[model samples]
Target: MSDPVRCMTVCRVCGKEDWLDVLSFGPMPLANNYLAPAPSYDDEPRFPMDVIVCRSCWLMAIRQVVSPDVLYRHYVYISSDSRQILNHMRDVANLAVTRFHLPAGSLVIEVGSNIGTQLEVFRSMGMRTLGVDPARNLADLANARGVETLAEYFGEGLAGTILEQYGHPRLILGRHVFAHIDDLTDVINAATRLLDPAGIFAVEVPYLLNLIEGNQFDTIYHEHLSYFSVGTLRRLFERHGLRVVDVARFAVHGGSIVVFVGQAESQWPTGKAVFELEELEVRSGLTNEVAYQRFAERSGRTMRELGALVRGLVSQGKRVAGYGAPAKGNTLLNACGITARELQYASDTTEFKQGKVLPGTHVPVVSPAYAHDHPPDYFLLLPWNYAKEIIGREKSLLEQGIRFIVPIPEPLVVSNESLKDAAFSLSHG
Candidate 1:
């Protein structure tokens, strides 16, 4: 099928190779298109969800334009759910306070602030806090929850609006939001205008090293316009008059880099980790085509084996279903070509997506109750991050000796006993 939406997807950080065909989730609808009714029989337009790579910069990206208006207009993510994430936000806030010397009453603004879970902590510390998010529903929710928010897309234009309404923020934070884009210049300009002279702009994104070494292709979706690394990110930020001062590798989001940047005009230590990571990125082969070639080759082998396993179970008439309709599940379905015939339905705890189908595979999403009443002979846990959580939550279902498979990072099965013991069930799927 021909692609619909027209989007120019040049590498934002560097003028690398114009294109590299990464993967194609054929004719997929929006990843977050969680509608109750099945997409009507009426023909619906399909935009290209095909992914690409920048051979020169070693950047992997998606080619699509669902427009932030349609994608992030009703943000559903909440930050406080994961204890690790909650603590990370508070720790970063403290770091900004001490390191940047963000004075009390000075502003701290977060672009793409979903649910204001992070900003609430900043507000408690006497910092004037503002949240910019396109999600209208979440903006109203944040306002009701006492975290003042502006319901609009953030860019240089929005930055001007903020400067006119509220004083420039002393600390600007964009977490995973940094990589969710095809156009980043507007955001860089926005940061320049909205930040005070010495203010720091901190971004936490999944390290490209993690994406490569960990085989995190599921992190590849339409929403994530470009996957970033210290090398690409530093180049992108510095080109916009911002400097990457320090970076810390954290265990969040598979593996991540928490980057600290300040005005190119400001004087900071330019920590050793800065150059070390850049060198490591080069040595790690992030900028070379070889790394991507290797990832794609290994992925081919991985998918064939797992696909055979699932197909075997299905052919045996063993009823199979899945848990956690995850983002990565999109890639898995496309790569392995697991269509709706293999699994009956997939279940997720998020109400916003309860009745929707997986974007590319058209796999129906059911509520968790399906596990208790009509459990499938086998259960597949799609979100490996919350595998333990799913195992714990559905221990009773697993007690029936239903085999649970964990796809990716090398597929493995969950033993019934181990699944029961891990009752935390705190899945971020």
Candidate 2:
């Protein structure tokens, strides 16, 4: 006899009980819980991260539900670290202002606004920006930097408070956060109530199609409760009396989309992109269980290939180091079973994560100066999504014979002459 399947039975979106088991990453710790003083490995907590597909709604999610308090109260991942992300947010804000005809002095509220990066961009555009974040430290930092932010989680109750204080917002947005909420129903319900009738409610999330097609299995962690597709998002929004009017794809965070939504009765016309993408997803079997099963199979092969590559390098007396200390990097390291023994140390630009050790693997993290002073034979590109930025910034290292190992869509080593001056090099073994 085996243990019973211990998780939610009903889907979060639709009240459907039909689910298909797709991928299981087994027991894993919180990806963002990097240890500053390096806690004892024996004391760390690991939760089962088995992902399942809701056949009725086509929503993919991890059944193991970790409380928001456990994962986000002391959040360490800040959006201000990457210049690329900042520039992307600026473009999003500018587009929103132009498309929606938002005037100066209009209210803009962002949920899960880490360090208020996006809100800062909105404020500079003459909009009165407000941020709601659960992380106390980050909220304080944002407030100190002139972004009016409330250190509280957004919910129906908070929505009432915002309406009372600031009135309805002209625009409400959440970037890379719509998937993290365990109770998205409450959040969406609140957002609809707080949004002005003609206001646009924009959200950016990791697209499920991109995740499966790009082989970004490492993005699956306890923090990300759901992987969304436009089809599922449309259904979810429609259920709340909101319609997704416009959808645009971006090359940020592997692949993502900014969905513009408004009240069902609003005048914003639905764009053809939404239906086109939805049809593409259906054609790709995104709503089918078999596609997810195949994704799981492909992910297993990737883990094995990445492991073999790292072990082979280590066996040849080559020193390996990680380029970034991101949460996705932690998931990739733990899923592939790489540790400090194989990867000597990881380098990061974030001052907070620089002196810490990775959550599960206990891999030490040091400043980029360390890697620059004593370059490793191989620098594993942990934040491979930012490969272009990293390679361009560290062009000198490539010239000094330090090769980069990109472990995404496929595992490859980059030391080719043609890519010496390029953003990222791709040379497969």
For TM-score, the strongest prediction is 2
Candidate 1, 280-333: lDDT as tens digits: 988988777778778777667768877888899899998888777766676677
For each candidate, what TM-score against the reference?
0.88, 0.95
lDDT per prediction?
Answer: 0.75, 0.88
Give one digit per residue, the lDDT tens place, for model 2 in 328-384.
Answer: 998899999999889999999888887889988999899988877878999999999
lDDT of 2: 0.88
**Per-residue error at 325 for model 2, in Å?**
0.6
Off by over 4 Å in 1: 1-4, 7-9, 16-21, 24-26, 39-44, 74-80, 388-400, 417-429
